[model samples]
Target: MDLDVAQVRAFVRTAEELHFGRAAGTLAISQQALSKRIARLEALLGTPLLLRGGTGVRLTEAGRRFLGPARRTVAAADAAVAAVSGADRPLHVDTWGHLYAPMRTLARVAGRAGELVSGHGRDLPSVAKALLNGDVDAAFGRVHPPLPAGLAHRLIRLEPVDAVLSADHPLAAEPALRPDRLSGGVLWAPGPLDRLDFLHRFAVRFGVRHTATSVNLGLGHFLAEVAREPDRFSLMPADVPLPRVPGLRSVPLTDPTPLYAWSLLWRSGDEHPGLKGLVTACAEEGGRSRWLEYDPARDWLPEPPASGPEPV
Candidate 1:
């Protein structure tokens, strides 16, 4: 027999309310429409489900038997919806290359095994929202306070930022970059949701001029745009390499600060066994991750271990 979901819903609601008029009101349909729906459901099932009696409605033996399967069908449908809604969009990792080093590595490993769909974002809120809404498989995000429930994360990189410039820019020839000299330029700011806004805040925190006009979430796009420009630049860690855009140079910042700490963010405790391996890969990559490195002795750190020092 052909089964329609709407018919199933109507049937369930009628069973719930027991009063046809109240059920109709609950479903926002006319009592007559509700009655017709019940008629259709009964006709399809080839059974008399309801008996009009004294002051209330009663379900026939067939109705009682069908209730279990009907509820199960609705539950199955809901589960299907949740899965589809969660899987329809590509999983968004809400951090730049520097922040999501471990997640990227794990994703690559998983990809080889044909087990994951991976992508990235450039900011925290976007990652958080996507994870909360089930749009991403995983992301690298900051350890923000009051984190939403059901997400698991581990530190992957703890690095200081440096100034990045075009080869032709004046600072490109400097011995080392400093925050004081990092301001007053068009910057490549990446945000998961609002790239420009996040950059402005970042600029303010570092006392750099936050007057950037162009920002983007896509690193590839940022590199392309910057390569074509003359005075545009932003502060990045020396270890976080950029795409080999011709004429682009990233220099070490002299008075570097702990500006970026990267982590892998995802729905925690998934039953998938592959996720455990992915999590292990991320935790092991911490501080020593290939994506960025840290030399603490020389005060040059990117994905460097917090305890060790490396000479510049």
Candidate 2:
């Protein structure tokens, strides 16, 4: 039997997300249209692919089995189209935090004329939204999962997270500190990271109180806050050069430090002619960098319990 590719896509996405609203948002379609497409697909198969009781949706046994073949079909279709057309569009790339050097390399690979919009998200999810909403073509950030159905990701680099404290603090003298040592102390962080469930759970497990601030403090103010408060701390990238602040100190976090596994994310099958080259640029830039390493084993963050779908 022939199947409509668009209807199949709608069913697959809705099945993955289990929420019509989110799936529709990802596909840039109305929820009603998405539901209708799924209903049509179900009619064609003469079986309910999803179990929509009351609270939300869950896949039927058929859906669980059909998902694999459905994905393969979609992938093959996209590949065929890409091979035939070989069309390319101008790409937009963006990121959060200080990922400038490697992103500059990406811009060069995208083409000197390609647009690179920086600071797209305060955190990863916002960046994912920008991609879904067509605000940007590509973005760089952490790869938290239950990601949308049609997004592609490449692990670019592992950025080491370290501790920032007052120079006069007792722990500052240590070459490296462990999470247990941070117990009972407060870690002041930018709002985004603190709001993440993984970080929150990890902090609680380690007995540290992670406090997020709404204000984006300047470097001077950041240092002042660390130095002025005895019980306060912050996190930073260990390999990145630190400013010489007399009262502030940066120390390595040893014994399983958290590494921000930076990745490049874009919608799969979109295949801008320059996207492949831009990814190559990120890989080569990651290769030459002394600070960023490609270690998948050490690049993971703690996973929190799944409540709903996570993006990026």
Candidate 3:
């Protein structure tokens, strides 16, 4: 049988708060509206759920019984909806960042029932807006100040930023590299990697001073450029495997570089079955498993960088 999720949700919130006024505030509606919703909900159930007295309000026998189990039902319904939503998509997203490999890996784990694709697109701000605007299904990237609005997020993975240096560098040959070892090398960085302002804001935290030059180039291009420079190097999503750019190679640098977390994001009101399915497929991947297609012959590991950084 179909259930009024709105009614159920209202009931659970009010019951937990134990006060209609407080619950109304929590639900971001007025007390009168909340009372009416509860009344409608009780009418549908054919029973009285709450009783108001001088001491405020209390659940009735039916409501006491319903309160305990109804919360579970609401949560279950939310889970079911989340499942249906993530698994209901044939389309995909490719925000420029490090979440690509793992995102694709999730699709593989979801099996043939779901089809996933990855492509480069607009900056995080715009892509996040696009997802909220129903342009794309989801985007993966970091936002320092938190997402603006009309968006829902689930963090998929954390990618450490590594000080990448040319293979010929003295530290590049080191097995265990640290930040201090990276001192004095010419640095390459995205103008804004995960909105941390590239390595500028994070350098002090990392205890390493870097000379920023190619901050405007995207991650892919920066890596390629760093690969070309004989003595130049940069920082990138460490987990993502970098492909060989002919004369270049990348190795980890030591320091307290910020580890950027990328999350799966979508518009709050987007309920398209295709998009939802795709989202669920991604959410299920997490770090426990990966769901992407990797090409090895290209000098890159299974799932290195997905998209480039935004142009400064």
Model number with the top TM-score? 2
TM per prediction: 0.52, 0.64, 0.52
Off by over 4 Å in 2: 16-32, 68-86, 92-139, 144-153, 172-184, 191-228, 239-248, 252-259, 265-271, 291-312
Q: How does model 3 score by TM-score?
A: 0.52
Question: What is the model-wide C-alpha lDDT for candidate 2?
Answer: 0.67
Better of 1 and 3 by lDDT: 3
Error of 1 at 62 (Å): 37
Q: Which stretches of candidate 3 lie over 4 Å from their true place?
A: 1-94, 98-113, 116-119, 192-198, 215-221, 228-231, 253-258, 274-276, 290-312
Residues 1-312, candidate 2: write the lDDT tens digits.
899999988887787678999999988999999999999999999999999878799999999988767765665566567557845544567776642233433443454334444555766667765654445667776677767655778776666677788877778888988767987667765455544544565577577865655355655566577777767787765555566777787788766677655668886655555566667666566667742543445443554223422233
RMSD of each: 13.0, 6.6, 12.3
Candidate 1 global CA lDDT score: 0.58
Which is superior by TM-score, 1 or 2? 2
Top lDDT prediction, candidate number: 2
C-alpha lDDT score of every prediction, in listed order = 0.58, 0.67, 0.59
lDDT of 1 by residue, 91-194 (tens): 33445454324343455445433255555654566566555433455666455445654456665555566666688876788877666676766665554324
